[model samples]
Target: MKRSGNPSARDTKEGLVGWVEAKRKPIGTRPLRIKNTSRRRRDMINRKSSLGVALAIYLAFCALPGIAAEPDVNSLPKERQQQWDKIKSGMEQEYNVCIEHCGGKSECEQKCRQAHESRLQREFLKLQTAEAVPAANDTDLVHWRKTSGTGEQE
Candidate 1:
């Protein structure tokens, strides 16, 4: 029985069956369930936990010991602290004298140079004794004398 605008009965049924078959095929088809919310939440939790663990380990290894072992110089024994201050003051005076000698008039330069050299020699001897080391070697002494502008040899 062929209809006017529609095809014959067998043709119409066959066309509908083809359309259903195409829909069943997987070509360009999406999944029934789209988003996996649980997996995404698990991944977020794992990332946060790993970051927290790494931060804790870093602080423990890199920061804790440095904070614990630092000594406050102000809390040193009184005698040691006083000796440190004396050494600091002497160093300051020696530096000023050296600067004046290296950049001043001839008479003032000579006086300052002598004072600076004497103080430096004293300090060198003190350090050598404290460290149980020999005084400056011949080459070192020669270099120092030349640098101090008190070289006796050419």
Candidate 2:
């Protein structure tokens, strides 16, 4: 009878030495029945990378409004533009008041700025709703205020 090269080929005992040899599988090698770990690790990495990319895209889109560039009032419709212009001018008035009233008081200036910004935000939202445009969230008024010469923080 020919002895098979694979000692662990059979579960049943061929002999004591054969049984021991069968139990002693080559180092760094898996049984034929076992799933390949390397392949599973590769698949796991692929899944993780895909999920990371998806999350990045989601965050980027969600932050669009907060990180938006200064809005162009002209981009809005005629009525909406006029409304935004009115709101902006009003905020400008408040800004002048903030600077003048606060004078050199950092605390007072900060409070005034906060109040003015809140009012501006409220009016901006009101204008958008009143306009009823499809793309109503069209302006980043806060960003505009910071960038525009009007009411910009010192």
Off by over 4 Å in 1: 1-37, 68-70, 74-154
Report the alpha-carbon TM-score of model 1 versus the true structure: 0.25
- Over 38-150, each residue of candidate 2 has an lDDT whose tens digit, in order, gives 86776777678779989999999997677433455565678888878887897889799778987789999878877776677777667655624233244665455565546
Worst 10 residues of 1 by lDDT: 126-135
Report the CA-based lDDT of candidate 2 relative to the real structure: 0.66
**Ten consecutive residues with minimal summed lDDT in candidate 2?**
129-138
The TM-score values for the models, in the order shown, are: 0.25, 0.38
lDDT by residue for model 1 (33-124), tens: 33556866766776787799899998789965654342344744565456656775787787686676577677776677566555645654
lDDT of each: 0.57, 0.66
Q: Which candidate has the highest TM-score of all? A: 2
RMSD of each: 21.2, 18.3
Candidate 1's clash total is 0
